[model samples]
Target chain A: MDIKPIFKTLIRNPVGLVLIATQVALTLAIIVNSLFIINQRLDNISVKSGIDEDNTLMISFSSLSDSYNMENAIANDLAFLKSLPGVNSAMATNSLPLSNSGWSSGVSSQSDYKGVEIGSAFYFADETLVDTLGVDLIAGRSFRSEEISYYYLSDELEPPVCIVSADLALTLFPDLNNPEEVVGKKIWYGGVENPKFAEVIGVINDIKAPWRGWSEPIFNRVIYVPHKPIFGKFSRYVVRAENGQLDNLVKNIQTELSNFDDQRVIRPPRPFSDIREVFVRNDKGMATTLTIVIVLLLLINALGIIGLVSFWVTQRTKQIGTRRALGATKFDILTYFLTENLIITCIGVIIGSILAMALNNWLVTAFSLSKLPMSYLLGSALLLILMGMIAVCAPAMRAMNVQPAVATRSV
Target chain B: MLKMNGLSKVYRTHLVETHALREFSITVDEGEFVAVTGPSGSGKTTFLNIAGLLEEHTEGSYQLDGIELTGLSDRKRSALRNEKLGFIFQGFNLIPDLNLFDNVDVPLRYRGFSAKERKQRIETSLEQVGLASRMKHFPSELSGGQQQRVAIARALAGEPKLLLADEPTGNLDSNMARGVMELLESINANGTTIIMVTHDPELAARTRRNVHVIDGQVTDLRTVFNNDNVERTAETA
Candidate 1:
């Protein structure tokens, strides 16, 4: 009813005001940033993984002994695995989906055609590798098996052959109407003396290795060559099992390869989603750490508010007693203290909202995160008000318990 | 009218127990001015506190406006204090932060009166103390007598049935003390019963009745020569 007196009392106490300000400010900072971290993690998860994953299983053989002819062993292994039951198609390559490992090489056209030009992701696969992976051939076609002999030219000679993805084709020729127009354009690889002119005979849809979202869409460049006869022991066999027999297919493959080596290590096949999760595991860690820091800050803010209100109750003991003697009920005294705190808290939240906006700008600039959301700030302020009430309860109890006689006595 | 019967106050500690008032009894009818006089620590303050309902009595009964006080709880005592009694203290216990107007308005505020009614009462009470024009001045800005008057005006604004003054002029110079005493006399003459405690025998002589308290007991009940009222009671040997 008489708000002027209440406000006058508030102005008389500066320490309590400062404490409320600090608590609200800290709450705003932590809540806003934690919400941002959560949003960013969710955003990363929803981005497409970019390749068909349900029918794929990757098996690696990186430790075959050199005493065994490596090229013959790999060729024999690919042939044997493809012929097994429940195995529809398979490819032998250096890595599989979600492996986050790949090779990159630079490209140019003829001699002296030098600019950084284009970078290509190189995959050494057999003719059937593209079909086995179920990649969409957007333009042109997959490499033919009959052209294997010409796929590899002399070591000191040029090989006019390669395949690329449609994303790379678009990047190289954004103004062109037909992506296939540049299919035969000559691109040279390596030094000019041993330069290889590769024709972009086919274009496939884009693929993501999951760890490369930050760089993938801008530079989806790649080149594929036929598997060479001279090979190393380091290679993988990717198999697409028939429908639901992946476990059986794995057991059969493990049994089929048991005769090759005694000390072979064949890890269980992880699902595509699990593999993608491994790539985004760092996002999870970031979110968890932000969450913990936010919780700690909130707890600290709550304690600060409690300490402030306690100090306030103690300082105003005489005044509270006087108020009680002046016909104020215990509920009246409690409401007075609680309302005072709410006022201080609301003021602090207003200032803190401004402070959070400034801090959010600085954070977004430093960390390149999204802008601060207004809803997060408003929601945090409401939360601070509720927390402020809880914080004031202890001190309100003290205020209501003060005997009227205390103020009656002098000093 | 205010009445007390067999009133006593005892303060106890873990190690010692002390009696502040022993069977103290007095009665003040409407329109009477009663002055209680004693040396420091002679239970005069305790008497004033108990009469004002500011403290609880260890034993005894008190009645104001025909309402019993001994059986009432602390909350009820507070309500009675707010509704029926007003207090003025030796220290001129005006809230230092509030201006004269707001100070006088406090008791009325507790009474839950309308804002307009509080303003009217505050102005009338301040005018009675010759402080209507100084309503906006804070306690520290006024002289000692003015502060005491403001304290009296604060009590008066409540329109209490009984006014309790505890050394109301103790901190003032002679001139200010006399001025405050005269104001109390005038307020009392208007039919508001006043029970004041004073160390100055001269101020005690001016009241209609004087009660001398010593060692937690009232030793003398006397009416002096200047008035038609005269009575005496001797303590038991």
Candidate 2:
């Protein structure tokens, strides 16, 4: 309760106070920011990709003869995949979700595709796209069998109709609150020289772009066009097996497909779980490394406090005895030391808030990071204060046990 | 008033037991100034520690201001020390980091006094000890005599019924020791009982009575002095 006097004495002899406080400040700054990044990676790793990841697998192959019919080959492959036992649906498409390969493009609501533009991942598939990828059609209707368009990448024609992801629907038509209202909005694409427009025939609930390790604003901004993209020398299909049958199908799909179409070289089939694993591998590693760093920093900070407070208790033994003899109870002595540390920790946290913000500002410039929230600072400050109290407990108890008779001795 | 009857203190270890006080008996009336004189390890400090509640005696009954302190908890003893007793030590024991005002405020803070009352008592006690002008000065900045005065102010600020001094002038020069003795006599004249332990016979002679101890037992030195009555001091020891 003698905070003013105790604080005055502490500030006059500030070496120990400054040392421990600097460690607290540094630890808080680093840990809070590191925790933010770790939470970010963790959040990304767990975000819903809006697909049935457990039941989907991808098979890709390259044909030996470039003179083959692309549509016939894709139709034949799809028929074989869907006829297999336990297979729910199948589609020959451009790329799979959460895979490293992607198709990104810019689209706009204005003619010539030049007004308030945003980038999006484009998926080219047939009428079975919804059934094959297992994405929910929250509003409007899927592509009809007669509306399906077959083309090669060499042709510069864009699909006239597409089903937009929920995020893309909201961005392209910001005024519309309901997804059903956005079902009829048209967006321009393909560039100013060859301006092409597509009507939004439907809206999927959600989906992520196949890319990772970049800014997050573009992940769910995607659109799936009803186009069966055909390349003469290359082909791929996404097949959905019934639950619990994906691993078995993945094991046998490549061999079966290669045997059925011997003119093409079939690559291995990968289940969606494997694609997701490869996507977040580096992010998980970064999160784990930062987590270890935060824990070690906290330990070092706690140890620094323990060492400093123990030394203070040792050096001030006679002072403690004097206070005890002056009618201070053991509990009073303990309170004195704890209150003193609380004051120092309070000062450190104040400085740490500023330091954490400063560190976050630098991170924003270097890595284009987001602003650090105030909750992180408050939470981390509470953590540091708790750790400080725990670290100083043993030394404070030692201080409390100093013999009152020490005052009568000739020190 | 203070009383101790058949008080005994034992220090025990795994190998040996040392009896610091053997059936010690002492009685001091209200407003009396008593001096306890003895050599080293002669139980002078053991008596002082027991009287101040700094250490507990193994066996005995101790009463201060008519309250029995035997078998009390540490919290109650601390409360009694803060409420009914004051102490001034040989080394002054002034916390060197604190200024004169804060040093004097130590005991009052333990007594749970309000900030206004604590400050008032601190200033008044410093004025009584002739250090009112140096309230902001640290103990290190003051002379030995001034530091002892600050210690006296600290003890006086509590306004206790009994004051205990353990070699209050052992570390001071002759002139400072005489000045401190005058202050103690002045404080005693204000109707507070005092028991000071000292090695200097000259200082012991200045008190109204003396109780000498040797080897854990009371020894009547029977010093010739201008005592109005020797029989009363004799009966107390």
Candidate 3:
């Protein structure tokens, strides 16, 4: 078919064509940006926490009685949790991964704090912390049983040994090529005035901290110290259950702890997966909202095309009848309308691709997001074209069904 | 050549059934120019539509160039129409957005002619209508007569075997009507069959044969002049 005639027709109605094209372009820009943000959030949510998320459960409680000895209560709690049915291992720790709140301290290679200090989450647990959290040891060994010690409130006791994550170890000793070489190196944890040095006994593969946003680089920097009672008031136990035993353990663990001692207020036991869900709930909500907006945008864009095409069809009824009388078939009429819409959509898509990339660039500069890939742009262009075609189908069919006899009648 | 026997057309609704044509019949030889005259709403347009294969009849046996037309699929009928028929309307139905040349190319495009062939045919047809120099002018840019000529050029570009004109000169002044009539006569002189529906007796008298329709039926059939009689009359004049 000769598109020259169609082009001429469209040029005559420049305002209408431009409006449709602008609508398509804006729709493309909005949807592409929304998709990019949604994808980024999804990727952030899917990052590995380097913990046994499915099998681990955390129980947090505070000792309400002033006479409650934190050391004895935590020891009793750990023993009771470990003896429970289907419980693999248990340890009392200061904080749990994905808990959304934890303790953090700065670590430095020099005892005099002469250089920059790297911030890391302080994960103080007993000798069983490594096994209970399911963190893999890449080099050296975990703290020995004799190395475990109690930490009271405002106590100045320095731990004999500590374990660092692979990321933290690299940050602490950037000059060292091998991670194993930093295993025995001593690092300062507390203030410079009373510098508490603990030898790095082991290097864990990767463990995420709960102090900051997961998107930050400091998320995986963790330093584990051998402190049996992580705090004086609160006793938080990290318990690992056998396969398929999480839901049952979470349901009965509160009652079991209460039976052991009723003075402390035991919060409900929570699965690690639930805590992770709470940690990233805001991101999930943003992704869902963006997805909804994209769907609505596509629907509105499709409706715009349908409305414009239907109006054009109605306006050109006599012209369609004339073409029908001139030996143009139904398919010819349908193709003419579809091709006209395709031209408009193509123009819009071309403009929209540039607009989408520019918007993505702004997003990267403003929020530090990754650049939008070409695959998304091409995919969105194809999707918009398909949407335009679908939206034009009904109006094109209406044009196709115009009777040739209408040409004989006066308009 | 065209033939229709016992053709009937019924326009139906839930409350009424109106007969547009009943037992209508006509035939035109391959090289003959025939005019159909009727009062308003007397079914001349219905006959023209059926004869052009633009519509279906309620009851009929129609044949065009010896091929059965009734009960054919829409695709087959459209192919036949594209291959063998052309139409000119009283409204001078030139698509306003297209220029004269593009207007003439409509049927050729549907006929699947190559670009070069379509361009040649469009030029030739526009030249025949004396509008070749104004081929790039849009319909809105031309006068009424010029637009009609473009519509006629559109009809001629397909080189159809049968040309159907429904009051093709109805919208024109007398002078413009005569010019279009002369053009039709010249086209028919080249041996293309024509069936023209008109309300003017004078125009009908100029054709080789005249058929009068009334109340959805053919009421009269007469030959105004044979080819030999027309030639002799022309020579004597």
Steric clashes per prediction: 2, 0, 0
What's the C-alpha lDDT at position B171 in model 1? 88
lDDT of 1 by residue, B109-217 (tens): 7788998999999999999999999998888899999999998998888899999888888889999999999999999989899999998988988887788889988
lDDT of 3 by residue, A129-192 (tens): 6679888888889988789888775777588789989988988899988779998999897878
Model 1 per-residue lDDT at B51: 83
Ranking by DockQ: 2, 3, 1
Evaluate residue A187 in candidate 3 and report its C-alpha lDDT on the 0 to 100 scale. 88
Top-scoring candidate (TM-score): 2
Ordered by TM-score, highest first, the candidates read 2, 3, 1
What's the true lDDT of residue A85 in model 3?
Answer: 97
Report how far off residue A356 is in candidate 1 (Å). Answer: 1.7
Worst 10 residues of 2 chain A by lDDT: A209-218
Q: Clashing pairs in model 1?
A: A121-A221, A121-A222
True contacts kept of 2: 0.66
| lDDT of candidate 2 over A1-411, digit per residue (tens) | 769878998887999788888888888899889989998999878866788998998888888776777778788988988888879999878887778786888888887665677788988878887898889999988998888877687887578899888888888778889989988888788877777888999999878777753744678888888877776578778899998899889889888887887888899998888888988898899999999998898899888888888998988887888898888999999999999999888888888888999999999899997899999999999999999899889999999999888888775
Model 1 regions more than 4 Å off: A12-15, A42-59, A63-209, A215-232, A237-281, B12-16, B39-42, B71-75, B224-237
- Candidate 3: true contacts recovered, fraction: 0.64
Q: Which has the higher lDDT value, candidate number 2 or candidate number 3?
A: 2
TM per prediction: 0.73, 0.93, 0.92
Clashes of 2: 0
Each candidate's iRMS in angstroms? 2.3, 0.9, 1.2
